[model samples]
Target: MRKQLTVITALVISFASVHAQDATIEKIREQGLTQSKVMEYAFRLTDANDSRLTNSPGYFRAANWAKNELTKLGLVNAALEPWGDFGKGWDLKKSYIAMTTPYYRPLIGFPKTWTKGTGGLKNAEIIVIKAADSAALEAYKGKLKGKIIMLHRTDTLKPTYKPDAERWSDEDLSKMAAAKMDTSRRRGGPSRNVVGSMPITTRIRKLAEAEGAIAQLS
Candidate 1:
């Protein structure tokens, strides 16, 4: 009698598990096929502000919009809690940069954040520099005065036939899961064994300013 009771209990548990799995699958199908509102919410959030930097006015507007949206969805206590003060905000009114001399081309570039803008349309010569360190920078000491500096070599672009977006196949996912992590020490730690000086990106920017370069392009 006890053995029969144990078998019966096992059967009941298995049945309950199957029922729960079916319910979960049904919920996923309902949400994926019919009841999802992802795009609607995304459009509302993005359209509320042009730019949403943390300290900008547009950010506050977007925050309020999100709070209101949550409140409309019957969420309780939707509020923007104030964190500590961030730095000052900035708005870009008008920006235009183009290559006029040697070839008339519309240059694609974005100004660095928190930097002063070029006063209206001003033209300057492009000075290409391939300096990787302070020692290499000595060659262009007086040459960068009143010029736009190109600090890095341009990469060649190639056309591809593949689609822009794709879902990972089962094989691709399995390969990613099986990939090994690199446990080796990085080269630039605080130890004496590390080779090479500090990074040249910031140092190059400072050198450009000191040398009177109008702008530095990466």
Candidate 2:
């Protein structure tokens, strides 16, 4: 009789717990159905503000907007805290590049971050620099000034054989999740003999800047 009473008590407790959970879920569902602001929040985050590059004006605008919105919703002490000095912010207003002489054809390219703009619509000569090593950079010392330079040779475009987009299979995801840390790469860091002390591109850019090259097409 005692065992039967204990079983009955357990069932009663279980039923009460389940009923409480159901009530909580129903309240949440009702709130979502009637008071959902999903689209509003999405538009405000994306289309309402400019792109949010770190430490940029657009980033701050979105952040402040978010803070204000949260405060309106009764969040306590909603504020943005200062993160220490991040370098100056930059934004692209407009970019245009084309070949006019050979035949007026628009070239597809964007300026690199922190690169100085070519003021107004100006036509400049393009020079291709093919420096194999630091020693090879000496030949173009005085010639690069007032010119747009291509750091590397033009690549030949090839036809694509495979689909441009692909979705990962369950097996691929499982393998990725199971992947272990590559300790061998981390053990010795990087070898100096295999790689140069300073990158070739950096050296090239420094030289170009020092010599007053108008722009770089990379």
Global Cα RMSD, each model: 4.8, 4.1
Error of 2 at 165 (Å): 2.5
Q: What TM-score, to 2 decimals, does candidate 2 have?
A: 0.74
Clashing pairs for predicted structure model 1, backbone only: none
lDDT of 2 at 83: 80
Q: Give the distance in Å from residue 106's predicted Cα in candidate 1 to where it truly belongs.
A: 1.0
* Cand. 1 Cα-lDDT: 0.80
Worst window of 10 by summed lDDT in candidate 2: 185-194
lDDT of 2 by residue, 94-132 (tens): 999899987899999988776777788768898888886
Clash pairs, model 2 backbone: none
Q: What is the TM-score of each candidate against the true structure?
A: 0.69, 0.74
Backbone atom clashes (below 3 Å) for every candidate: 0, 0
Q: Best lDDT goes to which candidate?
A: 2
Q: What shift in Å separates residue 30 of candidate 2 from its native position after superposition?
A: 7.5
Q: What 10-residue stretch in candidate 1 is worst by lDDT?
A: 189-198
